[model samples]
Target: MNKWLYRLKHAWAVILGKAKISYVKKGGFSFRDFTYSENEIQFLNSLKIEFLFSEFGEQRVNGGGADFQDKRTRLDPSLTSLRKYFPNAKYTVYSDFDLKIDGVNLIKVNSPVAHPEHPRYGYRTADYFKFLSLTESDADFKCVLDSDMAIVSSDVIALIHLTRKFGFCVPYNDRQLLRQDMIWSQDTQPIEDESLGLGHSYNQSPMTLWKDDERGNVFYKKCAEIMKKDPSRSSLVMWKTAWETGIYPYILPKQWCLCDGNEGLGEEVILHVGHEKIKEYYDQ
Candidate 1:
């Protein structure tokens, strides 16, 4: 869909008090369908932080059907809420298309690998761009956020402080299970086993922070190596490497970044609404 027409429809939906917008595949809707308020833009410009998000046009199921018709719609509210919460921060959207949001900057980036298919996770090539951005971004402190979540609190500023002090942070989570033999294979799991001791579990990547210093640069280099080995399994590889390298992520408190309907929605910093079906639970 042409970006302007989608924005028009989105505006109409808001004027009608409808939070959910019906999206049909190829309906000319993009992630920017939910626009930001002028005040929101002003607020974002005031913050000195930078945020990164990535999106692909439309993903198809294994059989080539529209897997989730409302996936983008489900993401709209979260993105809208993030804009409201972090008005002063710089939000950069990385995608193949040039996206425009009132308070967001869109950067056109190419996939690092051909077909960038995750062998095990089935994620699209676009999903791996965050790693590239982490390495190349000039921001002193950069945050990569999933489109499926919203920041419900200003504690993110505190989180940034913590990341700056620790060198890196990800939503505290468990170590990913990997095959024993695959542990040493870059094509399977890229990080050296020694690095896994930093943390035994994979910090969920739904929300993560990276600093632009020595530690942060090392993390980015590791991520790049892992992605080159297996673009499709980059997330898993990252978790594995972080654990093996003893570069475990500083886990964010649950109250700060809850996922899958953990609770305390009113006080949490972020709510990661997993998928369309799960999002309905929160929508209610």
Candidate 2:
């Protein structure tokens, strides 16, 4: 069976702002503060399901002073809150140390790439590839999420059913180009493809549903291999190849994910909290 899972890139503040996406702002984060409000608590209690959260770790915030371990700890509330709804649900927090939430295991990716290198290190896609490696052996259906994401109770069931129907589900909207000042290139081919339904758009937020099967592992390995070959150019090559070839058919778009960006303030449907802005969203 095909897996249905959502994925997102945890970008930095500068990157997030430049991408024209909005995010939550609060104090810096600590594991103790991730507590959900009573309303938030009640909402999570309503769902009775299990899901995996593949949160990208602190590497995304290179320049920030926020503590990585604290951010990781802060996620416990969301994990605990999720357990309230998904009793059988387990969480696998990917990091250097193995931790557990409820009965869920926290998988660790001690790969060399996880270490600090240069200013331009740990590309968001690279972290995703590493996280995927950790899940390659699991047997349950997998649902990957960016750490900054919060889902509505209604979307829970719809996502499950939708994934079952379509081999994959992605939230797509008109892909708007970054401002002229932020434009990385004058590439119009992709712009046209986005218009023609031959292109896809997303930060891969709570990109959901992955079957605990070989196909999932195979797909993960394929991505890993591509990055291992040339980590720097893999993203560009992937985009280039996809554009040159008709690859959008492989990705489904029946229920395009919604981004706040569509609403004027540019809410990133998946709220990509940048490193600099971590303090803005969570109490420091």
> After superposition, which runs of candidate 2 have C-alpha atoms over 4 Å from their true positions?
1-50, 54-72, 76-81, 98-102, 112-116, 124-126, 130-137, 170-198, 212-218, 232-260, 263-284
Model 1 per-residue lDDT at 26: 27
Candidate 2, poorest ten consecutive residues by summed lDDT: 26-35
Best-performing candidate as measured by lDDT: 1
Give lDDT: candidate 1, residue 159.
63
lDDT of 1 by residue, 68-163 (tens): 345444235456765564655667877766566666677876666544444533243444666666666676667776666655444345566577
Residues 1-284 of candidate 2: C-alpha lDDT, one tens digit per residue: 22222112213322444222332343321121122334334544544334555444454342323344454443543454344435555565665544444466666665443324643344534345443543453433455544443332222444555554543333443343222212342211233334343333333434444454343344444545544543433233333334554342124232223333322222222222323343344322
Local error of candidate 1 at residue 250 (angstroms): 1.4
Name the runs in model 1 displaced over 4 angstroms.
Answer: 1-47, 59-75, 114-124, 174-199, 203-207, 243-246, 264-267, 276-278
Error of 1 at 185 (Å): 18
Q: How close is candidate 2 to the true structure, as a TM-score?
A: 0.52
